[model samples]
Target: MSSRESILPTEADFADFRKQCLSSDNWANKYDKHGRQVWVEVHPGKKKNQVPKVHKIKCKMVIDDVPAATMYDVLHDSIFRKTWDSAMNESFDIAKLSNNADVGYYSWRCPPPIKNRDVVTLRSWQVKDDEYIIINFSVKHPKHPPNKLNVRAISLLTGYYIKPTGANSCVFIYLSQADPMGSLPKWVINKASQVLAPRVMSRVHSAGRSYSEWKQQNNPEYKPWLYPEQSKLPMMNPAELSIQKADELEQVDETFKVDAQECEDSS
Candidate 1:
């Protein structure tokens, strides 16, 4: 069957996300990572409009010898996330909104001294000809709420545009705007947010290149939510998660041991 025939998003849904995926604005501060061009721009807020800081990021890179479908798989597949995204703590669909839309939960591992942040998002994805677009925004759901351990961060907008460049490669574009809902000033937050996206985008390119091989070993049978014809899969189990607090605890111990060794050697 054809890929367009195999995916499930509606024409209206595809149109909406495609618009956002391709929407362009003047972006500044361009740099390079992993042989890909990366840049970030902060939209200055006007208090009269009630807008806080908005961080706009863009990254472009070509993954050699990987089909666009495989890159799409890397971006949308939840089961194979842990293989490339080291910061992702947990992620899964909360409910199927439609054949092509769903609510998702994602939690990330933050460095020490700052608690982890999580978000609930509504996602829509579709493949048109050789181009694929997946876009999402933060939302609130009753079943999932702010927990004691992790703070909830609002994702104003997050999107991806994947277009085939050749028989074996594609260009990946990522855009993100988020509000952590903290006491930090808008300028302070925007600057801090700028540092995160480039790192995330760099990791994404590395992951996209390895996706095909990773999926083959991890869970080749797993079908994505975009593929409605496939059988339904359950949400990830809390116990089934590969990265847990135990792993964080081990890292803490390792740091402590290193500190003790440093003192002993110095004395």
Candidate 2:
């Protein structure tokens, strides 16, 4: 893989991906609950010994009484994430690549016997007319390599699209095309298709509800994403990053017996 600044996600890349997220032609509706709907587009891996299937998931919900800007802040507030993102094991900013983009490290828990997962991603954001978008895709960062504790996952494309409906409400959309680098069991796949999106959206909505108050008590005026001049993260050279491919990482077995209790708890 070429280690060049050009490898990072760009304005055109974000624009094209945003179009895909907004489009509905190829997406197959999968799950819907509590006003949230999820659609999945399954793409079989091109070659052998790669991930068998890559899932492009799109989920959306109308969040009432929450402004699009507030929901945007919720996604960027790492400190606030720690409190509500129970599945998260560890996360932090690695370096700033630009005013609208950065490289970061994130790891989260998987149900027992599935092992944990981690990723280094190049994240970017933009505010279009009536919309707020934040996106991230996996990247290999030299300073942070894969560890034995968590399987390195590949996030092909993942982000949020928030469009204001009114002053106090917005339509929240989450889109992701990711490969969890492991031998996924049939049951795991089934559970993911059925509940992952709704569960996550619920958590996000819950977080958004309380974020304004949380921000006030915390660093009320500190928003590095909106005002990059305030960021304390060291600037980074994009030449150090490359695409993180699933075949380059060690594959772990995510197939194990999970009881009803464990399944319920994970969701």
Measured by TM-score, the strongest candidate is 2
TM-score of each: 0.73, 0.89
Give the runs in model 1 whose Cα sits over 4 Å from its true position. 1-24, 32-35, 39-52, 231-267
Pick by lDDT: which candidate is best? 2
Q: After superposition, how far is residue 19 of candidate 2 from its true place, in Å?
A: 1.0
For each candidate in turn, give its C-alpha RMSD to the true structure in angstroms.
Answer: 10.4, 3.3
lDDT of 2 by residue, 1-267 (tens): 264347667778778877977898767788777889998865444454453455677889988888999999999999999999988888999999988999999888877777788888999999978779888889999989999998887887888899999999999999887766677654455456456668878888999999999999998999999899999999988877888888788878765575422332111
- lDDT of prediction 2: 0.80
lDDT (CA) for every model shown?
0.60, 0.80
Specify the poorest-scoring 10-residue window by lDDT in model 2. Answer: 258-267
